[model samples]
Target: MSLPLPAPVSTYFEISNGSDIAQVTRCFTDDALVVDEGQAYRGHAAIQSWQRDAQKKFAYSVEPVGLSRNGDRLTVTASVVGSFPGSPVQLYHVFDLAGDRIRSLEIG
Candidate 1:
């Protein structure tokens, strides 16, 4: 069964799985922040570049398996498979939403 996700989170996974970098960037707020691999990307331009770079660096697919909420924060646990070292891994995608857009996202 699929967990019910917030609009921004749902749209994020949709564009991410489709490898639509441009649309993915639009899923966040203007001053959005994304942290992946301990690296921080602030603002749209940085996030856009990060997505583009990551898309080129890996061929991956994510399947959201679970979710949890804490006030305005929503955490999605997803199974990811890709060309990276680990064939399959469970990742926590923690999101902080502001209004209809995502204010920050951290992938671990």
Candidate 2:
């Protein structure tokens, strides 16, 4: 599905839950940047490649719990269930939105 640009928190939840690399890429601007852990991915090409690698390495479900906005920044806290088993892990995503697209995303 083609989502609204910049997308809502639920949109992120859906894309992450589905682990849809294409959908995730569509949520960002052409020159967006994503920082996860200590790695940084820039632009749509790099982001798509990163997501593909991540999907293959990690099997998990991402459920968004809450969303908060401060100016152009939006933060989401989500519960993640890894395929390895055990309790669900918590992940925090901080998004910097520009116009209708995501300019930057920091995930931890």
Candidate 3:
């Protein structure tokens, strides 16, 4: 089942699940911030690098199972399956959107 997320959020997941580096890069703002695996990536270039590195390390799939909103921030809980220590695990992705682009995202 899919949740009705914001356009940018939905686009983010779509491109991310497909592991399209270029498209994924387009979903974020120029100064977008992403925190993942205890590392902080700032700016589009850094975020792109992070996404690429993660994709190269693990072939993964994310299914958004839950969503909650607070002002401009949206929290998404997803079930992720991939080539990692934990084959499948649930993760919380907190996203802050700026218009149709993602301003920041923290995943754990």
Per-prediction backbone clash count:
0, 0, 0
What TM-score goes with each of the models?
0.92, 0.81, 0.93
Candidate 1's C-alpha runs over 4 A off are: none
Cand. 3 Cα-lDDT: 0.87
Q: For each candidate in the order shown, give its overall lDDT on alpha carbons.
A: 0.87, 0.74, 0.87
Instruction: List model 1 lDDT by residue over 7-108, tens digit each.
Output: 888888876676566775557998999999999999988888887787789998889999999998999999989999977999999999998899999999
Measure candidate 3: CA RMSD: 1.2
lDDT score of model 2?
0.74
lDDT of candidate 3 over 27-94, digit per residue (tens): 78888989998999999778778877878889999999999999889999999999999789999999
Consecutive 10-residue window with the lowest summed lDDT within model 1: 17-26
Of 1 and 3, the candidate ranking higher by TM-score: 3
* Candidate 3 deviant stretches above 4 angstroms: none
